[model samples]
Target: MKTIQYIAAVLCSLVLSGCSDFSDSINTDPTRPGVASGTQLIANAALYLPGLSSSPKGEFMAQYLAETQYVGTSLYPQESTSFYSWYEEPLMNLQAAIDSDDLDAGEGPIANQIAVARILKAYFFWNVTDRWGDIPYTEALQGSDNFTPVYDSQESIYNSLFEELKAAVATVVEGDIDNDIIYGGDMSKWQKLGNTVRLLMALRLSEVAPARGKEEFNDALNDGVFSSNEDNLVFRHLPEANNQNYWYGQIVNQNREWWALTETLVDEMKPVNDPRLPVYGNPARESDEYVGLEFGEEENIGTEEYSLLGSDIYAQDAPVYLVTYAQVRFAMAEAAERGWIGGDAATYYNQAVEASVEQWTGSTEEVADFLTQPGIAFEPGNAMKMIGTQRWVHLYMFGYEAWAEWRRTGYPDNLVEPNGVPVPGRLSYPDNEVFNNADNYEEAVQRQFGGDDDIHGKVWWDQ
Candidate 1:
């Protein structure tokens, strides 16, 4: 684990010796790419999985729902740079690595890595399409085959991604495990995460393609899904130097601005006096020193006595959550509550809250108290809402995660749309898609708002 892994991870650029950039061609053994077959690529990339295990580092920007309330203000974030990086660089590059070899090989690690890479690629693209309408796909990663990949319709991309995950997961061959981290090469967990991804993506599809999304999701869940935490797809962080909390570094090092708890999140959590609030918020120096930046702020305001968009930030000690047991439980809670699956929402609902606190703070009693709060407690709604709400709360550091959830569920309904940056409501197409795949981008644009650049324009699936 001492070596960094780039297998579909940002650390890909981190290089074996920590080179600041990894955008150059990857040659595991610079003297061996010519002789490297599929096995070599797979083994090398698969070996990268151990490095993919990013510690509890940054603020859970994925879970933070960045675009919703964290942005347009001083969240002290790296914009969508990190999000897009995960999508375009690590995720896309890993997929390209596979084209280096055939996907139909006998039992081997590269093939397995390719199959898993495809699944992970689906996950990455799903996030990209959901957040930003049109994105480069077909020709995007060809590198040279097609210098530019066209932006596919958000709907088309979703359908294609869903299919990719389903196909890759189905291609699992027995005795094919060389470099796996989530399961230590155990293919069983691979099956679980793939199924879980299907279920998760399917549900999200409903917002854009109701009948299709629901139909697809129901089919996957009915077959089998992540039954427990062990089956979860998460990156556990080691509390070590250069591998500490992502958001922690800023807070501890006084990285100037940080995306703190908003009045909405703070107030919502405070109703039952959610103890997690303390775990989530940073008290400003004085009452007038408060500045809460919600989503949609036009500009960043310095600490001039504080504002509501982001008056305060969370502690540096906060964890950078990827996916978690609580999230899966919340997903189940929503499925059960809504009859998407057969179970009780209350059970999964409480389970979600409990799991979240336990995962966040590693305390069962703390989670129980937080769940008892009226907001987190279950009532009657889409199991989606219940689970989604917990997801948002639990997503303090994982901004992008909650942002994706909010796009799908609209829970924790206290969304504010401030002016400036136009709220981008939807994500902008990637530069590659815009430049190389001009035709696809044009098609997607027509389907959206007749070529309007407004983020408010809904994609076909979204509509």
Candidate 2:
């Protein structure tokens, strides 16, 4: 943490002074100009990756972690979540970098920097489109020139993303870049990350458009992807107040025990003797065993009685895994079962489980024993269920991604809260969109949901 912070500080100082001596750049600047240097723009854009992965709303939606106190989100409250901040900040910064010629050659090759920006931009857009279905894509981040940008279909957005990711991977040069908080400007890892994201996105179309899914999946597989846990794309938080883990702030700094593991997670893991259970959360205070509270339990809700997040998870400097080898392996396993790729589904399944266990537990000592359990064992007929369930568990605090997968696969078909509200298929468009971009918003809602804009409306891929 100290080394990373020191490097960042030095890089920021150098960039602010208009020097090309350092290899990295600043953490984040909300007031940063759209015309900033390529390095500065990329650095600022990268800052939001951690927050994206560890979103509390996503956690609640996935029912992995529940609110111990307020409990509103756990009950599946209907709300208009905004993507404006995403576009206004990171997405814009990434766009600036992608368009800029102000390259800091000292940081990395200009090609690599642009590639990184493009990849991050695609990822940010991916998150937005997944959450809200159709979104302002083609005209987004155009600044004041396009406040009322038309919403692009989710299908189009995904197609554009695949192209962007492919181009980004191909654009990489043989040079390590700095100012990259993720991967430390490791170009090979960046290439793999891009391909991995493409692979997963391709797989999302398995049900809706399997031909495209198979072609893209194999294209990504052939290009290259994460082969080991060391290649995981992670955002390492600092111990400083400005960059501490979000969970740490909620649980430790604020002295508020607001989030706890849900019964949905605890029941699945505990009964199967899942090795990741201990690493996922702590044992309940009252039970002295791992106990997850019922999702959306408004009455008799005590923070200590239910398992809170594991200590390491909420630690100030904990690293959030953005994309991982385990995720790619699971995608491979699923593709195999779908016959989109030629390989034994069980091989990839076992490897995915082993990779996930090694990733969370930091050892494979118990993986063999854990895999022998009935629920954990890989049976070809039951492959999809096993793969989907394990993928959900492996996703952990990556709530939105898990929620998206759940919607796609209908896996763990028991995501209902105590109030009888099942997980929402999608978040409604932001209120700002309804008011400010009413015409386009209405058109999108009408096109996608037959004029409803409701939470239960399916995204393009989910359909």
Q: How far is each candidate from the true structure, as Cα RMSD in Å? A: 6.1, 4.1
- Model 1 segments more than 4 A misplaced: 1-88, 102-111, 179-182, 238-245, 252-254, 283-319, 368-370, 381-387, 419-423, 430-437
The candidate 2 region of ten consecutive residues with least summed lDDT is: 13-22
lDDT of each: 0.54, 0.84
Per-model TM against the reference? 0.75, 0.93
Q: Write the per-residue lDDT of candidate 1 for residues 233-304, one digit (tens) a residue.
A: 654334444444444454456544534445556556656666555455444545643334443343553333
The TM-score leader among the candidates is: 2
- C-alpha positional error of residue 377 in candidate 2 after TM-score superposition, expressed in Å: 1.1
Expressed as tens digits, the lDDT of each residue in 24-124 for candidate 2 is: 44654545432356766677777778878777888987889878888875677777878887887788777877776667788789999999989989988
